[model samples]
Target chain A: MNPNRQKVLDATLQLLAQSGLSGAGLNDVIALSGASRGSLYHFFPDGKQQWVAEALQIYAEAFAEGCENAISKAPTVSQGIANVFLFAAKMMKARDFRSGCPVGAVVLDLDCDSEPMRVLCLSIMAQWQHRLAAHLTPLPEAKALALAKMIIACFEGAFMLARLERSTAPLTLAAEQMATLLEAQLATVSRSH
Target chain B: MNPNRQKVLDATLQLLAQSGLSGAGLNDVIALSGASRGSLYHFFPDGKQQWVAEALQIYAEAFAEGCENAISKAPTVSQGIANVFLFAAKMMKARDFRSGCPVGAVVLDLDCDSEPMRVLCLSIMAQWQHRLAAHLTPLPEAKALALAKMIIACFEGAFMLARLERSTAPLTLAAEQMATLLEAQLATVSRSH
Candidate 1:
C-alpha cells in the first residue's frame, strides 16, 4: 500500500473504532487522512462501503498478527492465552475503550446476506480460531477448540462491557476468569496422567 | 404505556432484532406497528433515540423475565443453568440468529459518553448479573459472581459468533463449554468438603 493509501486506511480504522461504522462519515475520513476527495474516490470508487471493507481487512490481519505474536512470546499454550488477554486489556485501556476487535464490531453491522463482508469476517475469525487451536493441540483438540471460542467470546464480551462501563474492570475480571479456566483445563489434563 | 405507545415500542424491538439499531429506521417502525407519524411523534418527540431507549428497556426486562422463567422451571441451580442455555439456543434458532440479547446489542452500540443510554445499559446488565448471582448464591458467592459474568459473556459472545458464522454450532459448543465450567466449579467445592 502506498503511504497515502495506508494513511487513509489507518484513519478509517481509528474513526470506526471511535464512532462505529454508521457514525464514521466520509468527511471524517478525509479530514483524518488529510487526503483529498479525489484521492479517496480514486482509491475507493464505491464510497463508504468499499472503504470500510478495506479497513476491516486491514484491521483483521493486524489483530490476527498481534494474537500470533503473543502466542509465540509465551512459553506454553496456557501462558499464551493469558498473554492474549493481557494484550487485549492493554489495547482496550490505551484506546480508552473506544477500540474493540474490529472484526467483532463490523460483523454486527454487516448484513449476513452480503457475501463479501460475510466471507471476510468468517475467514478472519477462522484464522484466529486456527491459531488458537494450534496452541491448544498440545493439550486436547476438543477442549482447545471449545476454549478458543469461549476465549474469543469472553474477549469480545469484555470489550463491549468495558466500553459501556468506561472502566477496565470487566476486561481485567475477564482475563482473571480466563486464566482460571485455562489453569483448570491444564490441571484436568495433568491429573489424568 | 398506552396501547398505541406499546405497539410502537414492540414494533421498534422487532425491527431492531432483524436489522439492529442503525438499520431500523422510523419508517420501518411505523410500517411494522401500523402507526401514523402523529402517533409516533406523540409518544416520542425526540424520535428514534427515544424510541430505541424505551425499546431497549422493554427488551432488557423481557430477557431477564425469560431467564427467570427458565430457571424457575428447572429442578436445581445447575439444571437451571443448563436450562438457560437450552432456552437461549431455542430462541436463537427461532430467529435464525437474527436476534440476540437486545440489551447486549444496544450496549455495544451506545457511546460511553451518552450518559442516559449508558446508564440504561449498565443497569440492565447489572440486573441480569444480579439475577444470575442470586440463583448461584447457594454455591459460593465469589464463584457465583464470577460464573454469572462468565455465563453472560458466553451467551453474548456465542450469540455474536452464531450470527456472524450463520450457524448454531457456536451456541451449542458454548453451552457445552459453560456446562463444563459449571461442573468444574461444583467439583472443586465438593472436594474441599
Candidate 2:
C-alpha cells in the first residue's frame, strides 16, 4: 500500500474503531490522517465505501497474522488460545474498548447487499477458524472444529461485552474459561487415544 | 406503557435489531409503527435519544424476563444455563441473524461520553449477571458469580460471531460447550461438598 493510502486506511480504522461505520465520515478520516482530500480521492475515488473496504482488508490481515503467530509460537494450543485472547484484550484496552474485531463490526454493519464487504468479513472469520482448527488437529476433527468455532465465538462476544461494560472482567473470565474448556477437551482426547 | 408508546418502542426495537441504532431513523420508526410524526414527537419529544433509551429499556426488561423464565423453569442450574443459550440461539435464528441482544447493538452505537446510555447499558448487563448468579446460588457464590459472567460473555460473544458469520452453527456450538463447562463446574462443586 502507498504510504499515503496506508495512512488514510489506518486513520479510518481508528475512526471506525471509535465511532463505528456510520459514525465515521470522510472528513474525519482526512483530518485524522492529515492527508489531502486530493490524496484520498487519488487513492479511493469511490469514496468512503472503498476506503472502508480496504481498511477492513488491512485489519483482516493483521488479525489473521496474530492468530498465526499465536498458534505457531506458543508452546501449547491452550497457551496459544490464551495468548490470542490476551492479545485481543490488550488491543481492545489500548483502543479504550473502541476497537473490536473489524470483521465483527463490519459484518454487523454490512449485510449481504454489500457483497465485497461480506466476502471480506467471512473470509477473515473462515481463515481464523482454519488457523484455530489447525492447532487442534491432534484431536478429533469434528470436536476440534466445533471447539475452534466456540472459542472464536467466545472471544468475539467477550470483546463486545467487555467493551460495552467498560470492564476487562468479561474478557479475563472468557480467557480463563476457554483455557479450562480446551484443557478438558485435550484430556478427553488423550484418554480416548 | 401506553399502547401508542409501546407501539413506538416496539417498532424502534425491530428497526434497531435489523439495521442498528444509526441505521434506524425516526422515519423508519414511524413507518414501522404506522404512527404519525406528531404522535412520535408526542411520545418521544427528544427524538432519537429518548426514543432509543426507552426502546433499549424495553429490550432490557424482555431480555431479563427471558433469563428469569429460563432459570426458574429449568430443572437444575446447569439445565437453566443451557436453556438460556438454547433460547438465545432460537431467537437469533428467528430474526434471520438480523437481531442480536438489543443492549449489544445500542452499546456499539452509543457515544462513550453519553453517561445516561452507558449507565443503561451497564445496568442491563449487571442485571443479566445477577439473574444468572441467582440461578447458581446453590453452588459456591464466587464460582456462581464467575460462571454467570462467563456464560453471559459467551452468549453475547456467540451472538456476535453467529450473526457476523451468518451461521447458527457458532451459536449451537457455543451452547453445547457452555453446557459442558457448566456441568463440569457443577460436578466439581458436588465433589467438593
Candidate 3:
C-alpha cells in the first residue's frame, strides 16, 4: 500500500472507532493523517464514502485474522474466546474507552438511504462471524455458528457498556460468562461423542 | 405534556435511534414532527442538546418500566430476561430493523469533546442496569447486578447484529444464551441453599 493511502485509511478507521461515520469527515482525515488534499483526492477519488468503506474493510479483515490467531492457539474454545475478550478489554482500557469496534460504529449510525454501504457493512460482519466459527471445528457447524453469533453480540455489547462507564468491568464479566457457557457446551459435546 | 411538545420529543428519539446525534438536525426534527420551528423552540428553548437529552431520558424511563414489568411477571430470572430480549426483537423487526437502542446509538456516536453529553448517556445506561437488577430479588444483590450487566451487553450487541443482518436470529440466539447462563446460576444458588 502507498504510505499516504495507508495513513489515510488508518486515520479514517481510528476516527470511525472514536466517533463514527459523521465524525470521520474529510477535514478530520486530512488533519489526522497529515495527507495533503491533492494526495487524498488522488488516492480516494470517490471521497468520504470510498475511504470509509475501504478503511472498514481493512479493519474487518485484520480484526478477523487476529481473532482467528487467538482462537487457534488456545487449547479449548472457551479459553480462545476469553483471550479475544481479554485482549479487547485491554485495548479499550488503554484507549481510555474512546474507541470501540468500527463495524459496530457503522451499524449504529448506518444511513437507511445507503443500500450499498449497508450491504458492505453486512458482508464485513458476516465475514467476521464466519472466520470465528471456523475455529470451533470440534463442534457441529450449526452449533459453532450460533456460538459465534453469541460471542460477537456479547463482545459488541460489552465494549459499548465498558466505554460508556469508563470501566472494563463489563467486558471482563462478559468474558467470564462466555467462557463458562463455552465450557458447558464443550463438555456436552464430549459426552455425546 | 402538550401534544406538540410530545410530537417533537418522539420524533427526536426515533431519529436518534435510526441515525445518531448528527442525523437528528433541527430541520430533520421539524420535517418529521410536523411541529412549527417556533413551537419546537418554545418547548425546548435550549436547542438540540437539550431536546436530545430530554428525549433519551424519556426513552430510558419507558424502557426501564417495560423491562421491569416483564421481569416481575416471569417465573424466573432467565424467563424474565428472555421476555425483555424477545420484546426488543419484536420492536426491531416491526421497525424494519432500522432502529435500535437509542442509548447504544449515543454511545457509539458519542463526541469525545462533550463531557456533559457523555455523562448524561452514562447515567441513562446505569439507570437501565439498575432497573433490571432491581427485579431479581430472588438472587443476591451482587449476582443480580452482574447478570443485569450481561443482559444489557448481550441485548445491545445482538440488536446491532440483527439490524445489520436484517434478521432477528442474533437477538433470539442471545436470548437463549442469556437464559442458559442465568438458569445455571440459579441452579447453583438453589444447590447452595
Docking class of 2: medium
Q: What's the C-alpha lDDT at position A85 in model 3?
A: 91
- The residue ranges of model 1 lying beyond 4 angstroms of the native Cα positions read A139-143, A187-193, B139-143
Native-referenced TM-scores of chain A, all candidate models:
0.89, 0.90, 0.96
Could you give candidate 2's per-residue lDDT for residues B15-123 as a string of tens digits?
7776677756888888888888999999889988899888888888888897888878888777777777787878878878766766676666655567787788888
Error of 3 at B105 (Å): 0.6
Model 3 residue pairs with clashes:
none
For residues A1-193, write the lDDT of model 1, one tens digit per residue.
7777888888988877765666456898999999989999899898887888899888877887888888888887667777777777787788877766666666666544566877877887877887777777657887787778878877788777777767776777777767777887778888888
Q: How accurate is candidate 3 locally (lDDT)?
A: 0.89
Segments in model 2 whose C-alpha atoms lie over 4 Å from true places: none
TM-score of 2: 0.94
Q: Could you tell me how far off, in angstroms, the CA of residue B130 lies in candidate 1 after the best superposition?
A: 1.2
Instruction: Report chain B TM per candidate.
Output: 0.89, 0.92, 0.95
Model 1, range B56-169, lDDT digits (tens) per residue?
888888888988888888786667777777777777788777766666666655544567877888888878888988887547887787678767876777778877776777
TM-score of each: 0.92, 0.94, 0.97
Preferred candidate (lDDT higher): 1 or 3? 3
Stretches > 4 Å off in candidate 3: none
In candidate 3 chain B, where is summed lDDT lowest over 10 consecutive residues? B130-139
How many pairs collide in each candidate, listed in order? Answer: 0, 1, 0
